[model samples]
Target: MPDAQKMFERITLPRDAGLPVSLCNVSKTYRTGFGLPVHALNLVSLRVPSGQALAITGPSGSGKSTLLHLVGAMDTPDEGSITVGELELARLQERERAAFRSQIGFVFQRFHLLPALTALDNVAAPLLPLKVGFDKQQRARELLAAVGLSGRERDLPSHLSGGEQQRVAIARALVNSPGLLFADEPTGDLDSRTGAKVMGALLELRSKRGLTLLIATHDAGLASRCDRVIELLDGQIVSDSEG
Candidate 1:
């Protein structure tokens, strides 16, 4: 198997930040060659308003990650519809989908920084293949400052702490100024203190940019930090309450 860091370095899949999202009776099933097919999501319906912060809580295989993937257009549902902002996902062609994805930012548990790049360069990687109006390094610096990594721009991934590296990943994800952000266990690898700081930065940016934020997490403390929380079980929503 390939090293996770090296794989990310090679593919460099840049993701985006916020859009009001809607899904209607969406279902996704994976058919393994062996026995019963696994149902990742089943008739799941949800609507997230623009600029809202929603946390999804569930045990493993409860479809939290699947929900995010479907909503983010990283994967498609086998049934029903998904709409983000003004666009319907299933209808978008390949090129259009790529363009749409560029406008959305995503953060994951793994930092995925290129081993060869400095912090500043890592944060600016997403912008290298696109045409943007802003200066990349300046944007990266501003984001690093926001995440409290001001003096660490020249440091490589190996030289930084886990928290700082994650922050760099966050900056890279947001380089396109996406309208929606999806975080899948973003703080799963950090200690409580570091995790809190990372979540704080994310919420601050979400509020500042008016981005809709969706976080999937096992930590109740982290889930409570959002404006609303939804619990999932067996690929279905079981509870949705205010944070």
Candidate 2:
């Protein structure tokens, strides 16, 4: 197996490549069991520039996750269009969408690590589906170290602290060298102090990699750290402001 340094050398992004996201009158709705219709997003539209961090802040049912899902290609909007870089998400075929999604990184509120796998293994798992040319294990190890988990590569999720576990998740997200990162309430599972550490690591990595970041959170403090913030209410954008 190649060493971490050698693996790191294989991870590269084009010097001018950065994904800018755009949404145009997007909407999503769900049908309830009782035959009621619930609007998750209603004609929402926004744009995020390349290499910039944007925060989505809203109340519990304000459709923040719905917006993230559409932008991340996890779900398609019921109406309008979503564009990430040059790809129109709603217009993509299954195969093309799968290919496009592989270029994005996602971190959730829960650290969805496998309890049976070591941190290194968890990070390397995502690369198994892709045709990456480098050693996934070494790349995972390097990502772990980059997130301040240099010596904890072998630690299981249960053995690490909350902050450390989140760090591991971040490393796993970055293992594929994604140009865009989507985080949905990434710090919601931790205490304030631990959350701060995780958020700091995320921001540092974004700066280092020039990644386009979109984070959905209720934390005002965390939102304040982003380059811009958009507030949603009742599935509609209520305010959009620069930080």
Candidate 3:
């Protein structure tokens, strides 16, 4: 086990627990160079109970990524508030947000692994900067193996298949044993069959770890596997249903 495994285990991964997240009247707007406004989210509000697996499905420009970004604390909304457990995202200062982010894991549709790093190093990257008491490489190894990448730890991102790279991103996201995980198009870049396998692995990991999962994806197959699914249109929740 890595130091992070022990150090943050109690803080992040309590038994049968995950961060409960909520948004109230959340809105985001972006302006182009010409000063026209694009409303990403308009008065959006939702509640996700702890350990619930929720999916966000919508077409392009439907505010899927914007919602994730706001909930993930990567960006702030123009109005309203977001609460996760006891913390309010809009109120966290820059430095506080950085520290708060350790409890959150995000996997983008595009695998953003550093091109120069091997799979192990990429997975171990987040722990390298922390003062953890356990071996970081060992933690990385365990995560890689959990994602069915035990023997390929030495492969660089460019050398791996699309699904493998996505798994590596997932491994990296879970390296900290985050209480919450956000995945945008978790399987978008893979073949339908491969995408299904990757989503299965992600959902299995989510359940095994008791993580509150939020995923935004266009693939209906991917969305249908979650505990709940909400579809977005023009930045609003058009449909919320059981997945």
Candidate 4:
């Protein structure tokens, strides 16, 4: 019988239209509580394509969070380089770093919402550092409604449930329409059902807006939902598999 199909693999996809993030030999070290040097990331190099949802999965203390921080330009690496698009983070001044951060959205497991500020104000905080005025308020409210928090816009973080708070954080992250979105254990604080809902919201954003995503999580189920999973062990990538 004739061959029915070719078994060869297809060509690798070209890089996305715009650069999202690049890390070259990045490493980070910290002083442990016992005063000994602890390696968080060791010569880790990675490139996150624009509009791809990538997950970094590892156990606690495996440097996943540290990597996320570096990618988002929230913290500088102790060694090597991290460049987002054409901007080299290490070479930029503090003010420039802050500006770059404004272009990236970040979500944390702790929610990190202000106790005094309403959800609307919390989402509007990122715009405060920028000079863009008047429109920021409207943008914040719009984003909050987009994340399904329309009725709870005036509620404080303390009044919102864990899932609601995470959704609010998502709105805050997207308020600036950041080119990159970083979430560190975004669903770790919620129950399984709520976690799934939050993950759905994130996936929806990635699909609708072409947002680049880097999610750090220990939940295997959540990681499996991403397009690719990079597994880390002892500050090193043990496996990178496409989903």
lDDT of 1 by residue, 5-62 (tens): 3333333332233578899999999888896889889899889988889999999899
Give the best candidate by lDDT: 3
User: Which portions of model 1 show Cα errors greater than 4 Å?
Assistant: 1-18
Candidate 3: tens digits of C-alpha lDDT, residues 131-170: 7778999999999999999999999999999999999999
Candidate 1: residue 196 lDDT (0-100): 93
**In model 4, which regions exceed 4 Å deviation?**
1-19
RMSD of each: 6.3, 4.9, 3.5, 11.7
Task: Residues 55-82, candidate 2: write the lDDT tens digits.
Answer: 9999999999999888888888889999
Model 1 scores a TM of 0.90
Steric clash pairs (candidate 3): 3-134
Error of 4 at 108 (Å): 0.5
Error of 4 at 238 (Å): 0.4
Q: How many backbone clashes does candidate 1 have?
A: 10
**Which is better, 2 or 4, measured by TM-score?**
2
Model 4 per-residue lDDT tens digits across residues 19-109: 3778899999999889999889999988887787888999899999999988777888999999776778788666656566766788999
Judged by lDDT against the true structure, how good is candidate 4? 0.82
